[model samples]
Target: MTTTAEHVDSGKAARKRVPRSGHARWLPPVDRPDPVAVLERQGRDRLPELLPIRYGRMTASPFAFLRGAAAVMAADLAGQPHTGLTVQLCGDAHLLNFGVYASPERSLLFDLNDFDETFRGPFEWDVKRLAASVAVAARENGHPAHRAHRAVRETVAGYRTAIRRLARLGELTVWYERVDAAGLLPLVRPARQPRHLGSSLTRARRRTSLQALGKLTEVVDGRRRIIHDPPLLEPAGAGDAASLRKIFSDYRSTLPEERRLLLDRYRFADAARKVVGVGSVGTRCFLVLLTGRGAGDPLFLQIKEARKAILEDHLPSGPYLHPGHRVVAGQRLLQAAGDIFLGWMTGPQGRAFYGRQLRDVKGVADVAGMNPNRLLAYGRLCGTALARAHARSGDRIAIAAYLGTADTFDRAVADFALCYADQTDADHAALGAAVVAGVVPAAPGV
Candidate 1:
């Protein structure tokens, strides 16, 4: 098996100094591996230890069930064969992870919404992970393998075709172009036969900044505040609040002076403990609501715990010294329109975390509601966006050349995805078992 370091070096070199435009450039080399063995390795340990922090509030839903399952999936994929091409991977690129969010320009645009595991690694790692998620989701929806494979193929094919097209465009073109929320509505029409199961996507798309998180938070006595909810939302006293205010002061130094001016417009309001997401449960997360000129003009910022990459234990370090910086830098590099508030800070305990707006009209397509046609379209969009992101950091031409005009890679990913989907089911079952055995306490309503 090729180690992560070996692949990273090659990936860097292959991508180095490539011109930022045209289709004449060389493609990056593809990374390779054994698929079945990868799967088996992931299955053995299951990494139950990672689960506690990965899951935020279990009371949210059963979907949160997969938060800590990354170790299990990683072990499972260790058993599969892989194409040698490596790039900065989203690390957790499920369909649900793709979404529409407000760009710094306030334009509603579509892109990958999560970056907790973002890192320079095997490119196929993302593709395989995404494919497997499709299969698992399909099975959960009672779709057969044949039907699932059809959706998977469409996704892979879209990715391949989109990359080729993106390769033909100039860097500026790629940077300026983005699929926005309004553009996606036609492609994501409500199901002809409406079912409660697929309504989340529609609901999510319609969700604006005020609609999604506004009600849960408020401005109290001219200070922006998040309503307290105990373990979910603990109150921070004056001392801690003052400490946070000071931290933001230091955080401003990390950005340009101009951006600092933009940040200064808001006054530090009240902050409360806020629990968010499945895989990020135990990690410290807080909502810092900032009030500008008045109560109605408010911004909700999230400060999330940033820890070592799950891949850090598996791979050697590179130029980056701090893993939290690695994550923040990687996110800015990969995302064309990142959050304006994107920055990092260390608390009194020396714990590190990245901070950004919690709600910016961010929303995702409901994969469950997507028909075959819409799924293919969505996949193409994601593929194009992913290629554009990789192009920003590495050699696009070399990577494109390695991909070529082959369906073999697609089929291989489908195979790995199917096998890995089975492993996820098993891991889910193990979690259930652990809950039953009282080894790990199950959160209420999960």
Candidate 2:
């Protein structure tokens, strides 16, 4: 197993996989699963009423559909020819999936924020998702086909260059490199809209804990509790208090000594059922409010239900034993730094869940308002971020060597993007047709 020649040839052997241009292929099996049935199956464990909301959002546009249809894409991608190179993938690596979040150091870092579907899989799976999402996003912003293609190329270029560069760095340097708000300027400056970057960063800085406390909670019964904005946000019901305590304790045990001590200082105040995001609309997500030393010192943690990653069924078996631990562990490996309180626990009812600060100056940069130049610039940043994430957990020499220096990989991705986007549009149309036929029961508008 440790033959010197084989060991030395590993990186070179990986490069001999499907040609860089082979990424241009996009095909679906004749008997592909109906997206409606897949969505319905995914909804089996979710709230029955909230499932419609998921449908409503997904039916909004092809881009929205892509965000919520990670399950469908996983199946399609499984059928593609991916080199055996694996990384901890953000199962749902859409354009919106990458954003600015606070690291443990309290500094804003731009990185992948959602890991609901994160798992060990081919690196191409994540890149394909990102490229396709960019294409759909360009359409949402009314960009032309040429501009959409250009955006995909930009993303691949950033990713290729970053992976290549990181392969040559010392291991520690690769591990420590990160992108933050202040560091975001240079990434997008070539696009020439520095004004928008300043405004976006300013808005993110304003979303502090105190600001969120004012917006999401109000005092009641001489104590502060999270506000109930019904349907979307409602008070947690009875019969779960015992399990909640166990969940909290178990989660605390998963943290390091310092973080556990920090968490121990806070007392749980209240929890409410809150629906969030496109794909996660129906999961049993709760916004848990905790008060620290003083009444005004508050912490809001989200306890989101963690089931099997949607990609797991399609991808090869992974290193994760528990899906909850899978999410937490994969996130730590990919992000430059993680939330101090990030942890996982299994509930008394045997449900798996992960806990984290609900927000950390974390805001999605709205792609709808941005012009083509800004979108392309943002595309590059997302690409570079993805490459860095891959390098952190993957064999950088193998991946980078496979990618090489040519733009062949770049153009292949652009081709793949356009093809998958068309497929997503068709799938979106099918969902819309179901809504019109009244079988899916989606809301009138998102």
Candidate 3:
């Protein structure tokens, strides 16, 4: 694989070669259509398309709401005047998507929890999305818009402050420092009436492994296979299972020689359909159980479908013709430590996906439990972490110069958040409308 420097240079050259005049502007124009209208249309369309992929497997809810949200956010962002500086964005930077997960080193760390929509785009888009999500979530929790606005403002301000501080750090310092599990307590102070914060932290700390998963998934005697649960996971057909078995062999070929050698120690024992994540619903995903020495010793791995980046329309494309490859490569570039099993392959049907371990001590914070103070601190941590990730691939000094010290960027993001939150509420109402009209089936207990 080419280096990150090469990728950035190529991307910049591509952007420069394109005609910058007229509608070809790198920054989107400010006078676009109502974001709410665009969001409503996107919400109605996304699920119908997904229904055929994994039919009758899920009881639909607002759970898949985030997948359809990308179009709404992207269309809204397209109307903004950006600084013409792009970085690899989280794409959907909702408060819930920022969370705690165990790193490869077995240390709990706070980082971006999802990257399905990740791509290179205007940095402000991420901040805007995050701020808007804070507003929406706060509103849903019954907080008034004024209080929600404060939360949104603080979140954006945190991003601005964090980025500026990171700009002052030495490159190595920025790369080496991460917000680890031990660091979280001081960051999120213990409240007299603590919400679910303590429990959430405890949940994140629990160790998870192949042994743990085996307990949750029983192996029937004679068959000796992973079983299924409705809406969460189901059994894969013989043909689909065979196809995966064959494709995994090819997948091994795509890895680096050393990684392939490392993987050879384990043999694939079984494969099963696995449902995962809110936004990633209906995408082709599977859990492959691998046994190393004996039946009792296993490693659970996930192969998930990779789709076109939501930011592709906004980015100057080069080097990355395949979006799946782009996701794998971009993830490696941005993350401090990635899954050692991380690799990509095209399946028998020519569909692309990425593979990694299914069971790690992966946990996310419960946003519903966070009070204003803790949320503010957590938001700062996310902002700081995001800056570090961006600095890994972009010119930090140039971005810092553009951002400066003024609160103008923060104010801009806050304005966008308030407007976009209204848009999301409208989109949510439209989704509820669809459910009422039976345009899309609604699940119980939504």
Say which candidate scores most in lDDT.
2
lDDT of 1: 0.62
The model with the greater TM-score, 2 or 3, is 2
Give per-residue CA lDDT, model 3, range 1-446, as digits (tens).
Answer: 65545544544443343211221222324565553354434334233544432212212322234334666567656654555667777787777777776776877777776777778876767777777777666665666667776777677667667666776777688777576766666666645655444566677666354555556467577544677775456677788788888887767876779878878888877777776655565577888877777766777778887777767666666467655676678777777667777777787567788887776666766666666666656666667667777776666655665555666556555655666666666556666665577655545431
lDDT by residue for model 1 (69-164), tens: 554455444434333455677777777778777777777676777888777765666766677777676666666788777767767766666666
Evaluate candidate 2 by giving its C-alpha RMSD to the native, one decimal: 1.9
What ranking of all candidate models by TM-score puts the best one first?
A: 2, 3, 1
True-vs-predicted CA distance for residue 163, candidate 2, Å: 0.2
Stretches of candidate 1 off by over 4 Å are 1-64, 78-84, 186-214, 218-224, 237-239, 371-376
Which stretches of model 2 miss by more than 4 angstroms?
Answer: 1-12, 190-194, 444-446
Q: lDDT for every model?
A: 0.62, 0.86, 0.64
Candidate 2: tens digits of C-alpha lDDT, residues 1-446: 44434433555576567778889988778999999899999999888989888999999989999999999999888877778888888888898999887777778888998998999888888998999999999988899999999999999898999998998887899999998778787767554355777677778877766777899998998988788897888888765655676678889888999989899899888888899999999888888888897878888888989999988788778877877899999999999999888999888568899999886787778877777888899998999999999999888777877788889899999999999999999999999999999889887454
lDDT of 1 at 268: 76
Clashing pairs in 2: none
Q: Could you tell me which 10 consecutive residues in candidate 3 have the lowest summed lDDT?
A: 19-28
TM of each candidate vs. truth:
0.80, 0.96, 0.84
